[model samples]
Target chain A: MAAVALKNQLNAHIASMFAAGFLDKQFQELQILQDDGSSPGFVSEVVGLFIDDAEKITGLIAGLLDQPVVDFDKVDALVHQLKGSSASVGAQRVKLSCEQFHSYYEAKNRDGCVMALALLRNEFYDSRSKFQTMFQLEQQIEACS
Target chain B: MDRRRIRVLLVEDEEIHRVVARAVLRAAGVEVEEVENGAEAVRRVRESGAGGGSGAYNLIFTDKQMPVMDGHEATRQIRAMGVATPIVAVSSDSLPPDVQAFITAGANDFTPKPLTKEKLGHILAKFGLA
Candidate 1:
């Protein structure tokens, strides 16, 4: 019963993520990939990788932004990578934030870029927290099973 | 693994993307040979071609953007070598123009990033591997 409840919670959280536009069909594709006999932790493994990549890219973006003269091209490249990775995992909000960041990056608008970076940072953490919660529920269910 | 298993050459710089793609392809019983960038991909293809069938690969999947040679350039190079294997461009940029650019270069097909088993299967089937 505990496992069943945990499973329900996981499912509900995932459904809410989609409903909130925090995730999309691409995420469902990840789930389907996991359903095959590939690896039980396929989704978590990939998501963990995304988090790691995002962290490094986030650091790069910060460093670039802090430079005396901002290099919009450099920042744009990092954000582009982040956007793609986020989209792959179906992190819709983060992907959208990245798109905004790209627009500011292209215009070479420092203030706008800064604002966009903050929004992207916030969305990244928010999405990471929700993903962590979902993963925790999954682990609990797996442990009980 | 079967000696006669179908094989694919995957070129991706991102570790996570590589891991996910390898898992999906391997799960479907296909052999995967992974390389980090387009340059390495072209080299591998060249090596295989020179060896006269030792490195026979059924298909190739490359990321559009990378540190070294991008997918389009790599595709053009491989095509120039007379390597007839199907080349598929996998990128996060799902925009029509971006995808069309890769096709124009030499990619036989284009699939958006976060490749799934179903999408991989679709690509394989399109090439008659399925």
Candidate 2:
């Protein structure tokens, strides 16, 4: 009964993510891939990787922005990578933020880039929190099972 | 198609992409080898091509944006060495211009990033490996 409740909660949370546009079809694809039995815990593994990579990229971006002479090329490259990473995991909001970041990056507008980075950071953290919640629910369900 | 198992060389700088792609390919029973960047990919292709078929891969999937060397240059170098293996560009950029650029760079095919089993299947069938 407890596991059943946890499972339902997890499903609801996931549905809310999609409904809110925090995730997209790519996340469903990841679930399908995990279900294939080719790799157990694949979703969790990917979420973990995404978080680590996002953190590192954002840190790099922040550092670059702090420099008196900003290297727009390097910043753009990092953001591009972050966008790719977010897309792979279906972090829709974060990916969009990265795309917006690119425009400012292209213009070499440091202020705009800073604002974009903040937006990206917010999306990344929100998505990361949701993922963590999902993981916890999964763990509880597994324990009940 | 030969009865031998399909082998693929995956050239990607990102670890998450590598993990995802490798899982998909392995699920389809395809053998996979990974390299981090285009330069390493070039070296791997060269070495395998020189190994007299023992280490040769049937297909190569390369990400277009990477450090050290990008996929376009890698594809160009591989083609220059006269390698006949099917080279597929796997990238997030899938627009017409992107596709044209990949083809211009000598890629045999273009598949967008976040590769799915179906997409990979089509690639295999298209290349006569399926």
Candidate 3:
């Protein structure tokens, strides 16, 4: 019964994310790929990597911004990487945030870039929390099964 | 078009992407060899020679923005070595300029990232490998 409850909660949380535009069809594609491998926790594993990558990249971006002379190109490169990584995982909001971040850097708008960074950071944390919760629920289901 | 005999070299820096690509390709009965960056890709290709010979790859899929060496530079170097294997650019950025850059650098084709089986099948068939 507990397992069933956890499963239901997982389903609801996923639906909420999808409905909120935090995820897209690409997430489903990742899930499908999970079945093609021996590792059943493939999606969770990838999600975990995405979070770690985001943290590192965002930290770098923050450090770059704090410098006296912001090297926009370096920050843009990081944003581009984060964009691709987020897209790969179907993190819709984070990818969109990266795009906005890139645009500000391109325009050489320091203040705008700072704002975009905040947006991207917030989206990353939100998605990270959701992913962890979803993975924990999945682990419960696996154990009970 | 014997899938089992088809060999590919996949160059991507990100671990998750590499894992996904390997699983997807293997499931389709295609043999895949992976490398982390374009420099390794160049070394691997040179080591194998060309024309899908015993140890050579039949095709190449390289990510655009990798450390050590980017995909464009790698493609140019491979072409310079006269390795005529079809090199396809695999990236998330499909902008015209991005696509043009890879092509100018010697990639025969371009495929957007977050690779799907359908997309992979289409690319393989286009190259007469499927």
Candidate 4:
């Protein structure tokens, strides 16, 4: 693809991500991740990590509510990692979950923490594969450009 | 154990999902006791998971979200109260992170929504209780 066409495609994906509430401010920060024109894998790696982080956060939340063991730090780390990765992915809703998860934990609000956990569930549940598909397309545009 | 008479709890809040669960699980040759809310499920299981009689239920399939008591809270409470029943959660709400939520809340495994026989069987097999 021509550089101009690739850039147009990239802009279009960013727009879709914004409309879907899957990409926002943090992704903007990531848009400039290339240092002296680094590999597009920078973004791909970050997006891959976001998926892994989502899986881990699931574990941490379970630990939080489990009996005979409540692993707060596990939950916290998962949320923190999710925040960083989603920010890089420009996943708006995931980043929002991370933010709220941290806010509740810091406040020592048990109910809030639980609520945030549920909210996080909804964010992922609500995100269709199309959202990720869009992200992948953007990755392609970056590479081709 | 008689395959046709094993007691099983169907924990779900959605009416349509509950009906579907009942039809599918029962067809598999297990007696299913359905509960629409998590709090009620915990209560039912507490009275049932004691294993005093031969008719006791050994398994459960619960939905993740609901009013009054979500699956996570119900699972946590049931485990804390000594119900040793293996729980298999089936919900649209199941994700990798949510699986951890279910386990932390005392569920044994997670199955994605639009439950399938293969997934259900797989969950039962995981605990060696199939």
Candidate 5:
């Protein structure tokens, strides 16, 4: 099965974090932010919020492709949101690409966004799965230990 | 000069951020290597692994926003591939929760810009590299 083939990838990273003796402060806090209401599943709630934001931005960016010259200024706002949320999670390289994409938007240049998109897609695509796995693994590891 | 200085790999997309990080790290006695994007960062790591040197990258300081590969994905990719190089997230986003998330995402530590001595020192100390 697909799950069986993909051996847990975050084991070493999590182990290293424990070895370093640092708690996952940001994730814990983000959990608090999402759980301000103390809902049933706080962590999922926050990540879901982020996912919704990602969906809207993706749709917005996609819609721009149909325009005459692709008003980059309009797209820049979406890029900023993507950049901010990603950066909030310390997605540095993706944020940097978005920053560049935002600046280049003023010149009405589309190439920068394209390149930034490649990086952003790679960042989100990789992070969503890996982070989710890491979180679940962390929970399992905690339960076991 | 002495063994005190650390070798830092900086992968960033913005010119100003690169300059600022370089200055901050240099002031902290770190020798910085600059790369433009995530693609180059991965290539550099691979090259370093293929007998390029001791295959040691003391610190990898990256910006969250980049073009070819953003900081988070690059960090995730590097970790997923089993690179031991300690990565530190450097960006302008100062939200504490976000900083924590960066660490959770497998960054050795996190620092937001404009790089201050306190933050840089704290991060370096967290990794025991200061």
Candidate 6:
């Protein structure tokens, strides 16, 4: 596709993500930084970091949950870190899921925590796919531009 | 005082936050030095001296959550050393209580994170560094 068309496609796709509540203004802030030459590939770099960090945290949560004596404090702290990471990258859905996960862990409700983790995982995977798609679109635009 | 570009120390564990904040600060013509946590922040302040010297920072920006030490403790420690350099707490966790805690711990100001050029400009202006 031509650069303009690809750019438009990217914008529309990003708009859809925002409309779906998968992203927020902070993501746009990142894009602005990228555009201003503050940091080339800023968005992709941050998104990549978020994905790597979230994956590790998710695995840690799963391991903690599987332990016979679950350490709710540790789980909560990990979830909090995940939430902060999500917020940093403007991963709204994942951040919201992490917030929901908080109440469950806070109450020391193992069942609730398990259920919330499933939801959190689903949201995170969905957000990750969306980000990946955006990255591809950006790459296409860059290639043609 | 000295005629030099404003210098700021950025304390944030998250790499992305550090990247964004450094970009914004550098764009504003401010010199930035970064550390991943508060203990390093304290050490940097101590080693460089906070008294408007040749290598001292004019300001400090720190996140609330970190591994070795939190912003509150770092701010308190820096203050304890009698370094009056302005410390601004930059965080996403900006509840009233959190802001109050930062102030009580000796932060000169508080700003929400995903630090923007405008927000940073306001901070610099507030501290007369702009």
| Top DockQ model | 2
Provide the TM-score of the second chain in candidate 6.
Answer: 0.94
Q: Name the lDDT of candidate 3.
A: 0.87
Better of 2 and 5 by DockQ: 2
The TM-score values for the models, in the order shown, are 0.90, 0.94, 0.94, 0.45, 0.46, 0.91
Model 1 / residue A122 / CA error / Å: 1.2
- Stretches off by above 4 angstroms in model 1 are B1-4, B50-55
lDDT of 3 by residue, B33-124 (tens): 99999999989988875623323787899999899999999999888888888888989888999999999999999988777788888988
Please write out the lDDT profile of model 2 over residues B81-117, one tens digit for every residue: 8887889999887789999999999999998888888
Q: How well is each residue in A7-85 modelled by candidate 4, as lDDT tens digits?
A: 7776786677688787665455344533323435454555555566676666667667654545566666567555544
Q: Which pairs of residues collide in candidate 3?
A: none
**Candidate 4 docking classification:** incorrect
By lDDT, who's the top model here? Answer: 2
Ranking by lDDT: 2, 6, 3, 1, 4, 5
Ranking by TM-score: 3, 2, 6, 1, 5, 4
Candidate 3, number of clashes = 0
lDDT of 1 by residue, A29-134 (tens): 7787788664588889889988998889988998888888998888977998998788778899999999878778888888888888889889999999999999
* Tens-digit lDDT track of model 2 for A1-145: 9898889999999999999999999898888888886566998888888899999999999999999999999998899889889888889999999988988989999999999999999999999999999999999998898
**Where does candidate 6 stray beyond 4 Å?**
B1-4, B51-55
Residue A64 of model 6 has an lDDT of 96
| DockQ, ranked from best to worst | 2, 1, 3, 6, 5, 4
- Clashing residue pairs found in predicted model 4: A22-A92, A58-B97
- lDDT, candidate 5, A1-145, per-residue tens: 3343233445565444435432234444443434443444544544454556666776788678556779776687677666655444434444556676665677676776666666666656555665576668656654554
Model 4 bad stretches (over 4 Å): A1-145, B1-4, B49-55
Q: What is the lDDT of residue B56 in candidate 4?
A: 64
Supply the TM-score for candidate 5: 0.46
lDDT of 6 by residue, A36-119 (tens): 775778889899989998999999999999999999999987998888888878999998999889789989999999899999
